[model samples]
Target: MVFKRRHKEKLIEATLFWIGSLTIIILILICLFLFRDALTLFSTHSFYSFVTGSLWYPTADPPLYGLIPLLLGSVLVTFGAICISVPLGITSAIYISEIASPRVASFLKPFIEILAGIPSVVYGFFGLVVLAPYLQLWLDLSTGQVALTGSVMLAVMALPTIISISEDAISSIPSSIREGSLAMGATNWQTIYKVVLPAALSGISAAVMLGMGRAIGETMTVMMVTGNAAVIPGMPEGIVESVRTMTATIALEMGEVPIGSEHYHALFAVGSVLFIMTFLINLAADIIKKKYRFKLEGS
Candidate 1:
């Protein structure tokens, strides 16, 4: 019996050890795959021109791979998504954390999570079928496929992420803080605004950063809704004009690109830019959190 128990323990330990090792190896492999492309990008192109230029004509014999328009389109759509999502998400989070009854919270929280689980492709389909036609009629645009459509879709997709994170942030605030504010004759809303929000600002900021990352990386939905025009045709006036995004550019063109071609490396370079941008945003959030943490701990 003692020998059998010892063997069982050994087997368990070996299994766990192998699992951890395999996970690390898989992560390394993924990093190498992504990094290989980035290295190729640097080898093939001037980093300055690739990031800063305006044109992205990859099929052209020389392939002017300026990523500015794609970058602009991504920023525009992400900006629109943030505009739509932040206020709505924050408000919903506040309601869930501070205002909603437990029954209401129970009902709504899962629904919001369910919204998050809906695939991007489905969101794309919804945009194409339902949103595109409505926008065309309402905006009197030639085609409904535009940045606005993509923005709206991305906003919807980002909603659950923002809401969930923000809700957790709000919920993390100490009830003592709320009670103290109320003891000082503050209204519930006032207490929430003055005490809870200030206390939870770090986490809320993190949530926004996370949502921004999601907005930046989204591909299929943006591709489906944004009319894949590489050119923005002067300053973007409305959502009716076609736009192309970096992720979309990669998805659309990578398949056709010959192995080791300039266009292929250029796409990887664009992806690297995206990864760096999102990483910086997240790093900024972390810095903000640390700064606030220092203040909180010192006080």
Candidate 2:
């Protein structure tokens, strides 16, 4: 009986170990596959011009690969989305975590989760049909599809992630801290603002970082609404004009490229840029979180 039990335990341990190893190996293989063309971008002289210059005529005979225009479009739209999402998302989360009744929170939480589950393409279509037209009417722009419209759509999409993370952070705050603040004659709002928020600052920062990641990576909605022009105009002028993003550039052109063409590798180069950007954002978030945690511990 002892031998049988020992055998079973060994078998399970071995199986779990192999499963974890295989998963890591598979992930590495996938990363390599996706990043293979990143190397070619470095080898080409056009790489600098592609990344730094504004011209992006990929289909031109010599295929100008300047990525600045696309990069700018992405930044503008993401910045707008972050502006819309961050405050609203954080406030909503605070309300749910610190203020709302249990019954109300229980009901609302699922609704927010449902919003996250909605498909990106659905969001894109919604932007195309509804938000775009509304923006055009309000701004009196010639075209409804623009960077602002894409930003609005991305904002809506990022809300779920932001709200969910912020809520969790606020909820994780110790009830004792709230009680102590109240004992000090602080109002509920004061307790939340002066005590709770500072304590959960790391988590809130993480939530914002996560939302920014989502805004940056969102493709379909931006593709549908951004008008897909590749011009490097100033922010004020570009806001009114059409624009393209890195994700949209790759999505739009990848299919038409011959399999082994420079264009194909260029798409991978864009992917590498995106990957690096996300990685750096996540790293920054981590550093912020650790610093905040240390501050809390010291206090």
Candidate 3:
């Protein structure tokens, strides 16, 4: 019996190892594919001009392909979405996981699940039809289809991911930790804020990273609502101004461009930039998580 159990364990371990290895292989293939097409974009255009120039006209005579404004747009919208989602998502998770009754949490979860399951196109439509008009009237912008509009819509889309994961992280903290804090005369809020949150910081960081990744890669909703104008606005308040993101740019223009044309290659290059940005963002989050976890454990 002992031998049979050991054999079964080895088989399960081998199966899991191969599945993980296959995923690594798939990721390597995807990187190769992206860089392969991306290199062609720089064959004719100077890499400096492609990155530094402010214009993004792909159809004009001697068409220019600057990435600064698109990057800015992506940054602004993502920053705004993070600002909106993090507070609300983390707060809701705290309420659901720690404060709320099981019935209340159950009632809330289906709505979140429904929201998450809705297609991006439907969110796009909602942004276009419902949110756009309200922003236009309330903020008095020239048009409602701007970075702010896209940011809000993306925040809504990211909320389910953030909240669900964070709640799980908080709920998974051992009951002994809570009991210890309570025995030390900590108030409920103090225990939650001081002990539980620190214990779950790594998971919260992961949740935030995933939510940010989702916001940054969103295409349909951003394209439909962000006005798709590839120019940096003049003022800081221009976060409310029309802008375009890299993902939206690729989605909007990739279909009609001729195969192997400069435009086509350029779009692939944009995708590569997006891939790098996501990698860097997650890397930074991971570093922070490690530092925070070390501090908590040491204390």
**Model 1, CA-based lDDT:** 0.88
lDDT by candidate, in order shown: 0.88, 0.89, 0.93
Instruction: Put the candidates in lDDT order, highest first.
Output: 3, 2, 1
Better of 1 and 3 by TM-score: 3
Determine which window of 10 residues in candidate 3 has minimal summed lDDT: 232-241
- Reference-based lDDT, residue 81, model 2: 93
Q: How far out, in Å, is residue 13 in model 1?
A: 11
For lDDT, the strongest prediction is 3
State the lDDT of candidate 3 residue by residue for 60-135, as single tens digits. 8999899988898998999899999999999999999999999999999888989899999999999999999999
Tens-digit lDDT string for candidate 1 (1-299): 99999999999999999999999999788767776887787676787887788888887877788888888888888888999999999999999999999999999999999999999999999999999889989999999999999999999988899999999989988888889999999998899898899888888888888888899899999999999888743465845588998899999998998988777778877887787788798899899888877877686
lDDT of 2 by residue, 38-131 (tens): 6766676465686787788877887788878888888988888999999999999999998899999999899999999999999999999998
| Clashing residue pairs in candidate 1 (N, C-alpha, C atoms within 3 angstroms) | none
Q: Total clashing residue pairs per candidate?
A: 0, 2, 0
- Candidate 1: minimum summed lDDT over ten consecutive residues — where? 231-240
RMSD of each: 3.1, 1.9, 1.6
